[model samples]
Target: MPLQRDASPRMASMLLTTYRALGAAANPLLRVFHRRRVKSGKEDVSRREERFGRASVARPQGRLAWIHAASVGEANAVLPLVRATIERGFKVVMTTGTLTSAQVVAQIELEGLIHQFVPYDTLPNINRFLDHWQPELAITVESEIWPVMITELERRKVPLIVINGRMSEGSFRNWQRVGGLARSVFGALKMVVAQSDADAERFKRLGVASAVNAGNIKFDGKAPSFDPEAVQELQQRIGQRPVWVAASTHPGEETQVLETHRLLTRAFPTLLTIIVPRHPKRGQLIAEEIAGFGLSVAQRSKGEEITPDTDVYLADTLGELGLFYKLASIVFVGGSLVPIGGHNLLEPAQLHCAIISGGNTTNFAAVYRQFNREGGALKASNPVELAAAVERLLNSPEETEQLAVKAAELVAAGAGALNQTLEALEPFLRQETSRQRTKGEV
Candidate 1:
């Protein structure tokens, strides 16, 4: 028998070829995928064609800047950059992969910006997308190095820059196994303005020569906008009750949150635990799960009103984390407990929520560690520890207030990444402008 082939060598190239072939085969199947997503309220039926690399609207004329952000978090992180690029005289066509991100973009009021769905990364899809937009340059947000897309950008000589570049050690190690493909693909990037020195070093180790630390732009993110009137109304309704939030939680993590609630309720009888699932579509299922825990739950999406007897409130709505953050001083930012690499801690920190996180936060390792060391946030390795953390906050109002203040101070101190990233991109912006001037298109 032939020796079992080692799949490590040339694995990246092999994967890319298989990826494009699968994408080609997925073309017709996309309709079925879209239908299922639409039915589940995950896809926008009106803008489905955009996924096929078909332009929904005519591309704006002259000096177009194409920005791709994978989802809501990345899209939100790049908003300031998008606006700044527009101010610098480029028509930005921003692309996001998910419906929630599309809605997030729709909510923003940027005049020089147009939002579209990112095309599938098949050769035909990529070709069609490039032919129409013909962007002067491409900018992608944190870790969005699509191989096919990068190859196309290089072929067109459209310089690609990845701002706020991030690479986890696990990802770096995986890429290193196929160093040839990593180098060939990363070699095309004009620069990767990374979030931290560790991230920059990881990218450099993977053959990104121009990768440099620029801090994390999320520190500069605006405090999430919330309707004050709505917050006031909710406050009036809830009266004076002990409250906490388990926010941006993924599936398996909610069990831990529920257990924490169960333990906390013994001490604070009227304790209210508000769970904000990462995907709002799971509102009903989560609501049912809460009910199964012998907790009276109300879901915001279903227009269910919170009652005095309600033990849990499911804020299963969009763009409302700010509102929930204001209602509670104690918050457990989720995706940490179940090894999902954690969710953003900056949001809660910005709002002065005394933060609690779990052992895992590889997605935001640098920031999380900083927060933990400075007491800007508390870490709870298990469900029992989670309950203990919340109880600690509940028992000492002064400590809770101090921790919240410390976290907010840390967030403010972590600012300046936005300026650094803008500075890094200034050279490329000038080059694109000069090229346009040469072509008499400026």
Candidate 2:
């Protein structure tokens, strides 16, 4: 059903014009930031035919569904769903906005799954995309509501759903200002499975009454497997030393973490800080930054071994967070300390590592708030607090172990969301299957 008859043309035009201006500003900035993706062979520029209704295309022998996530974090949350979809005999096309996410999905090695760079959300591009892929159903992960894309999907009569949907308070305020136009976009989605009741209520305000409180799918992901031999080697190399990790550190946050590392090393002389920057390109820059701090730094990419006297070990490589998280007794999730809305704390939690985060976790506020309430995680307001949390966790091994166990249990309790989300998707999946059969694609 279209929204209540309050979608005035003047209002819609005003909203869209604002969106256009924002897009105009954002495009150049994003292009600059993602230049590495464009320069490297990682990104594909060729426009592929849509999933169906193209004369020269090869249609799938079975059913097909499309899942789109904005980046690595969102991509990780959708893995369980992707695996379940394939197990249920649906050909899944997973699309991500970043080169890093594309690489991660490729590594998943799911048989019936294909990974692609999501087409830009413009009329001709989206039309070309939809006309070719002709996905039976579309699922978007986490707050990606592209107007043209949603409108095109609606026009083609494809059922569109959003999984793990979230609207931060800031975003909600912006959308509220747009009024009816925003409501129309929200109404376009068939269903919204949100991470929390707070998020669901926000969607409700945007006119999406069908929003359901689905627990975060990030909590549902299985812990990454670590190489036993590698673990044995690393453990032997750093025996009896207290180790902590600062995982997925961002630009400004890395320096803060390094300062904290500097402060802690004075007391626990044998302490080791493993720093993993969110971007691989920033690894060298981080090495230089730490070098300026007058600490001996070893780079993982250079195959430099962390000596007993080494103060900092830079795990600069990509996709090895599992390894580092596995080694650490305590983890400080970065990006949060500096207002970047935090990265997934659940990853370290799954590995039974005591977790600490900064105060600015708006991106996953509900999840972190729940963890904080359960005593499964700690929050640090600034560099001083962050350093103290690390020092405190390191000095008290028993408390660290207890906190880690609680964090693990909390994550385990949240594991069934993927199954629930899959169950809720059944009706829509059935409809898509029926449509595909009638169109002779099955």
Candidate 3:
């Protein structure tokens, strides 16, 4: 059901007034935030200037389309769209907020694509950024709603579209309390193309008249590419060991994975567990924890050898999930185990791995619904269940292969989101060539 619009004059005025006041202090507030983030190793210290609207690269002369994805997940989801935009002959400037995202984008090597750290959302920073890039069209991916940035884009008459837009029940409820503010922020968007019907309805309730369901683009995303030689080397090293990978794991979830490995190894004897933490910075600490647990471990970052005795392979590197997924027959998509919502299940699924996940997947409810319906994925609420699921797959290669086949088939069935999203956004995209030269014209 759509939400009732908050049309109270007092609420509208208060929301606008509050934002304007915050705009005045945004510069100082952002500087303090950046300092803290840098000190805590959240922000890249050398590239910190980019967060203040400073350009790290020169802007192209041709018409540019700007797309912003908040971090690695959002960045990956927007890659196909970025490729489509480049194929349209416009220079693409992609901005993201995390170091991991920056690293991942660097490996993509897409023509006409440039990645930058997004500027802080303040009036001054927004103005400086807009003036420098001067993008004719702006696309914000997922649910990164930056009020000041949207307000500036609206003021500058840039056509703004929110692609793959999502609003969870929890987020919708929070937005309801500040309905007027939500209206102001969401109102700046020319269109909000949601990933699911539920999200589209939520946008409509929040006063987004142009909300449309374009399907989830993650399903349309290209599978992660891997280096052939690297994959071959890793495969040779593993020999005939039973392998399972727990990928994109968060902080507390690592402990659960470690415990699950203990159970699996007891049954399989030579079972190899690979853990790829979401953040590579935690590599050293994770290695220490493995050693403390008396498990023989090898760190990928350190180029440690994965011998027969290596119980855990700490794939603490970036841009190699595809390699690990290909080597492992069963994959546990992490983050779901500890209420961090879930990481992308499609990655491993598309790579032909049997998928197992935890019970908490509110962020990807729609995707999970289809997976459950098709029996393409298994769910476990705790370490014991997780171990059992892995053990079952390891013991039964035929069952694992069947699950893998179903997962790949499921992904193949939902591969038209890119064309659908482009069809919906064609009007805005066409505006970019409105002033193009004719065949014989100079």
The top-ranked prediction according to lDDT is 1
Worst 10 residues of 3 by lDDT: 431-440
The TM-score obtained by model 1 is: 0.93
Give every collision pair in model 2: 50-132, 50-133, 51-132, 51-133, 52-133
C-alpha root-mean-square deviation, each candidate: 3.6, 4.0, 3.1
Order of quality (lDDT): 1, 3, 2
Q: How well does model 2 score by local distance difference test? A: 0.80
**Cα lDDT of model 1 by residue, 333-411, tens digit:** 9989987888889998888899999998988898999999998999998889999999999999999999999999999
TM-score for each predicted model, relative to the true structure? 0.93, 0.89, 0.93
Report lDDT per candidate. Answer: 0.88, 0.80, 0.86
Q: Mind giving the per-residue lDDT tens digits that candidate 3 earns over 123-236?
A: 677788888998878999988888888878887778789999989989998877777777877788889999988899898888787999988888888898788898899999
How many clashes would you count in candidate 2? 5
TM-score of 2: 0.89
Model 1 gets an lDDT of: 0.88
List where candidate 2 sits over 4 angstroms from the true fold.
1-10, 17-62, 433-442
